[model samples]
Target: MLSANEIEQVYWLADSLGEPGQRIDDGLFLARVAMHARELPRNLRRFLADFRASNRSPACLVLGYPVDEVRMGPSPTACNRLREKTIDEIRLEIAAILISSCLGDVFGWRLQHEGSIIHDLAPRPEHEDVGLGTGSRQHINWHTEDSFHPYRADYVGLFCVRNSHRVATTIGALDPDQLSKRHRRLLSAPLFTFRPDPSYLMSKAHPLPGTDRGGILFGDPENLCLRFDQDYIDWPDDIDGIAEAVETLRRVIEASLIHMPLRSGDFLLLNNRRAVHGRPAFTPTYRGTDRWLKRINITRNLERSRRRRQSDFDRVIYV
Candidate 1:
């Protein structure tokens, strides 16, 4: 949580960006945000630095930031959101970018939202029962985000622009003690498969590294790292005890499920590799009033992940 003065400082910085949409692809935009990030409250900066250093937990929550609700107007519908969005709606994005830049380099996918650096999470009427960030009538299965990709985000940053419904974001991490020795070995072996998420398959992009069979767990003890997707994995019944092991893993994760109901001005940085996240079903009002959030993906380094892009300034990956 930020003090009154700290909150004011954040707004001051966001205001300077002035309709950040124009600067999303420019190097200056990131540089300026990094500058803003450096000047964040000393305590907040320390906390972010620590969060980046530690791999123990799956989440870090920062609260009491500022949102320009009055100027933002109604929550945008999925159909014309981008067509009518104004400067006020993007102020929160600038703030989110600034704070997230403190942890790592921000990035986005070419196939997702046409390479927009910031993404939106809001319910769409047509996809109420579908498995998407825009769905509101079905439970989104918990999984490591973009689990199929090798270049997946190191952290998933979500900023609650306006969540009147108080929807809960599901969170769970493996606890080594909860698993039996046999199950740990089973899950650690390379016997699982993951399919790319639907959002990434909207358009025909280049053939990227296909998610061949891989282990669910990583690291020496195999408890610290995990890659899982309940809906997108291919089930191979040939492997012995694979089904039982997965079932056991599911039970353990369910037992540790943590539901976080975020409010406006809340920013949550979720460690994509260390934890799995999803959300429960909620009813949405079509009156331009629904739970809304600004989202971004960040990686540890820029140059390391920069590959196959058209130019150095282009952050979106085509492959």
Candidate 2:
């Protein structure tokens, strides 16, 4: 966490470049900030390295930009179209900063769109009206993003641009010590099965190479990690304790959850393997005032992970 003065300095630097109603050139703004905050890159990297080395609970690195309240339209311009050159420039700057500052080796940064380009984790009225997108729903339930994929990201970044709906909260689960004996046994047992959601199976980018038969969870049993989507998993027909296992795991996650809301200009980076995150359902009136967030995926250096590099380009699907 940075001090109040440091936070204010960051905002002041960003605000100095553009007028209240004018859009700041993201690229120039980032370059200027980077020049002034040269130490920031190294400091952030050290923090990430130490955090990972200690194996402590999940942490949130909130950037100091003040929330922009005036631009609360339901549907803002597409991220790519907002200020094309500036957007790409800022993205590159941010990516460079992360690579220079974080614990992991930087692979690459890819931008995701809201529709077919990225997965809308929550149900939308245009898609389905039930399940996770019931407008009034509060809890997002615990789950990893695209867990069925064997090549999931090592770290995930969410950059907020519009968050007028302060109710959109991101909750993370971190209580490893409270796992019950039953929960431990089930997590260790290979009873859970994962399959691609039917609708997602035929899509151009199938997560894993093969058809279903993916493991629902991975990592050490004592410090469990999960990759499960309730709608996509397929429990074995003969599995006797499936129901109990699911219930026990849910209980543990709910009891240990931590909530954080992202305001404008806040960037949240999380260890995908160690933490599971989800957001409360938000009412999207298509009025341009709905919550909007930009997402980026990063793969830690395989050499650093003590593993061989699979490809020159770290392949990832946005949705």
Each model's lDDT comes to 0.80, 0.49
Clashes of each: 0, 9
Among the numbered candidates, top TM-score falls to 1
Q: Each model's RMSD to truth, in Å? A: 2.2, 6.4
Residue 48, candidate 2: C-alpha displacement in angstroms: 1.7
Model 2, TM vs. native: 0.67
Candidate 1 per-residue C-alpha lDDT over 1-319 given as tens digits, one digit per residue, 9 for 90 to 100: 8889988888777777766355554556776777778877888889999988887788899898867666777776663424555676666777888899988888777777667778778888887887888778888999998998878888999898888778999999888667788888888887788788777765466564456577787776844588889888865798888889888888898888999988888999998878889999999886766988778899887777677556676677665
Candidate number with greatest lDDT: 1
Using all chains and alpha carbons, the TM-scores for the candidates as numbered come to 0.92, 0.67
The ten-residue window of minimal lDDT in model 1 covers: 76-85
User: Residue 65 of candidate 2: its Cα lDDT?
Assistant: 47
Which pairs of residues have clashing backbones in candidate 1?
A: none
Candidate 2 C-alpha lDDT tens digits along 117-183: 1112322344333333222244455566556555556666666655666655555654556656655
Where model 2 places Cα greater than 4 Å from the true spot, the runs are 3-41, 66-140, 174-176, 197-217, 302-311, 314-319
